[model samples]
Target: MTSDRITLLIVDDHPVVRDGLRGMFAAADGFEVLGEAADGVEAVRLTGELDPDVVLMDLRMPGGGGVAAIMELTRAGARAKVLVLTTYDTDSDTLPAIEAGATGYLLKDAPRDELFTAVRAAAEGRTVLSPAVASRLVSRVRAPGGAPGKEPLSAREREVLALVAKGTPNREIARELFISEATVKTHLTHLYAKLGVKDRAAAVATAYDRGILG
Candidate 1:
């Protein structure tokens, strides 16, 4: 049977942020605040114990930043989807979290209703991005490259890479572009080989560094 409430584990460095999130979710319907963690280490530990449906993660923290925790959770095959709630939306911050398997990204200043919708979408394994972040990604992908000597990404490859850079998961990318997941993986493989990178993060970094993803 399907569950009615979405269970959440809120992870932020600030006690106030944690408290605020807890209080907000506690007052809402169709949601449950499972617990809170101050850093990535505790987030990972509690996630294992509590098994929340979604983790509202912060990007920057003193102990093992959010990216590291996201990577660890992906490696450990944790069941919870990570929805990043951070102050930073720069390419450096957004790309890593997405590559590390974050289900969605949202800014800390997002409206309460948007936050609620994002969490629910993430719990259903959908890709969510803040409007600013999405616009930034679109601009980056469409911007012309300064270095003309670099090998060019194919049109479709560029489309896939752009969505990937936007933190869109493979499933969503496939769905949006009307292709199969295997085709998306194939495009990623070719792009990775063309960019000479092993993973999504490296591919994005290389693209930016080479002015391919300006």
Candidate 2:
């Protein structure tokens, strides 16, 4: 990994997609493209060898598939953050990729600036998701089929969680609910403690898993 630049590995079965992403990064200043992989198997090998700061991964591939590759890489202790890049936007597609340990998900149509921003954020351990995808993921988690292994939160907590899942700031949520920001923070603290999550993204994921909000 280069010390100065944000190194990236582009992984996709399509040569066109990989090349396009590489060029896009190359034209930008903060990102340096380290390599490319045409399949999940190659992605795993590259993760071990190159150890890029971020991996721009595609979910559908011929060998090892995107999710499978992420599972393998993470299981083997690869340090790179996986950011799933795909065309699909459904709850099923987003949830599985996240559950399998993807740090972020961006649609192929994401604005270039947003994509680069997400890459930078993911490289630094912050989660990023396309707003629509984030909302869908949150809604699904709060929907039915969420509470099996996890306990549900109170209705007010669910409302707070839904706003959080939509990326609302604490102050903003407070305003929306006609409550104090401290109250919002208090609720988030309790929500995190109960869900065993430390941040907004994890809380959102857990909310969906537990059917606390939709």
After superposition on all CA atoms, what RMSD does each candidate show versus the true structure? Answer: 6.4, 6.0
Residue 19 CA error for candidate 2 (Å)?
Answer: 1.3
List model 2 lDDT by residue over 34-66, tens digit each.
Answer: 899999999999988988999999988887799
Q: Estimate each model's TM-score.
A: 0.66, 0.71
The Cα local distance difference test for each model comes to 0.83, 0.81
Model 1 agreement with the true structure over 145-177: per-residue lDDT tens digits: 442234678999999987876557899999999
True-structure Cα RMSD, model 2:
6.0
TM-score of 1: 0.66
Best by TM-score: 2
